[model samples]
Target: MKSGLTVRSDNYADVLDALNKLSGTDVLVGIPAGPPREDSPLSNAEIGYLQSTGATVEIDGEIVTLPPRPFLDMGIEDSRDKTTARLKLAAQAALEGNSGMAEQHLEAAGQIARD
Candidate 1:
């Protein structure tokens, strides 16, 4: 039962490392949604939400009405083609068993998404 079967794992470490980084981890674009920072009155996400959905508030005893803009939605929709190419590259890298390269591609895609 001792057949000489040699297994090569030259890229195993890199692949594992890359998988750890890739699994359940992804880039998020746009303002983060959360409460305001300690020093700020509003988070960027709050501002964006208000702008996208519109709101009415009473300021100094006067009622002010805001209009819906949906800028974030428009931006995400517009960037569809921009990041698709990079994501495809990442997929190719993964298929070729080059995990490190795949991670790079994913990073590039994230950057494109952010941009």
Candidate 2:
């Protein structure tokens, strides 16, 4: 389907130019939670520039007003760590035969994982 920022070239400069052409539009930028890596498609600097253009940014389903550098990285790591810890707790609860507690912990884990 045709979506936002459609362009005709695969070059980085072309893609960026197309994005820049989107000025004055209410853009919704959705970024998944994850640590930045060398091979990431877009650098944190680029994301910050995009946000500076007044685009509404959503990280892991929550709307945020900050740039996408340290803030997004921290949020991603925090959410991942919480999800892992909750999953461990759920397993421990199950081992203790506390089915109710295990279920609750598992539900919490799911929510955090989604984030």
Candidate 3:
């Protein structure tokens, strides 16, 4: 797919010319997240500049630690639902080999079911 400013060339001089033209743009300048091959020197330089300016940098297949897992942000009991739904979830989890999660859901289901 043709990206915003993707420059492709077979010769080194042509590649350098493309990079020079793209240097003045607001686009992210750097080798994409993969093998640091291809016409990527300009991209590497851009990554360095971005890092120096406090921008988070991610390289090939690097898992950036985002804020947190979404589940960890919410309390378990906040998932208020009917007993049947909880039991179904528990059963599904059990069938899927998630015994711990199943037990948790089953416990919640049992509490609601008993009431």
Q: Using Cα atoms with residue i matched to residue i, what is each candidate's TM-score against the true structure? A: 0.66, 0.33, 0.28
Q: Estimate every model's Cα lDDT from 0 to 1.
A: 0.76, 0.57, 0.49
| Candidate 3 ranges beyond 4 A from true positions | 1-81
lDDT accuracy of residue 4 in candidate 2 = 82
- lDDT string for model 1 (19-94, tens) is 5656656767778788787876778788788889999966678999999998877876788896888778776776
Give residue 101's error in model 3 in angstroms.
0.7
Regions of candidate 2 where Cα sits further than 4 Å from its true position: 1-78
Q: Which pairs clash (backbone N, Cα, C closer than 3 Å) in model 3?
A: 30-43, 31-43
- Give the candidate number with the greatest lDDT: 1
lDDT of 3: 0.49
Residues 1-115 of candidate 2: C-alpha lDDT, one tens digit per residue: 7568866645565434433433222312235435555775556656655654545667778997764344544554668778779867766665555556666776777666445
- Superposed Cα deviation of residue 10, candidate 2 (Å): 65
Which pairs of residues collide in candidate 2? none
When superposed on Cα atoms, how far off is each prediction in RMSD?
A: 4.3, 23.6, 26.9
1 against 2, candidate with superior lDDT: 1
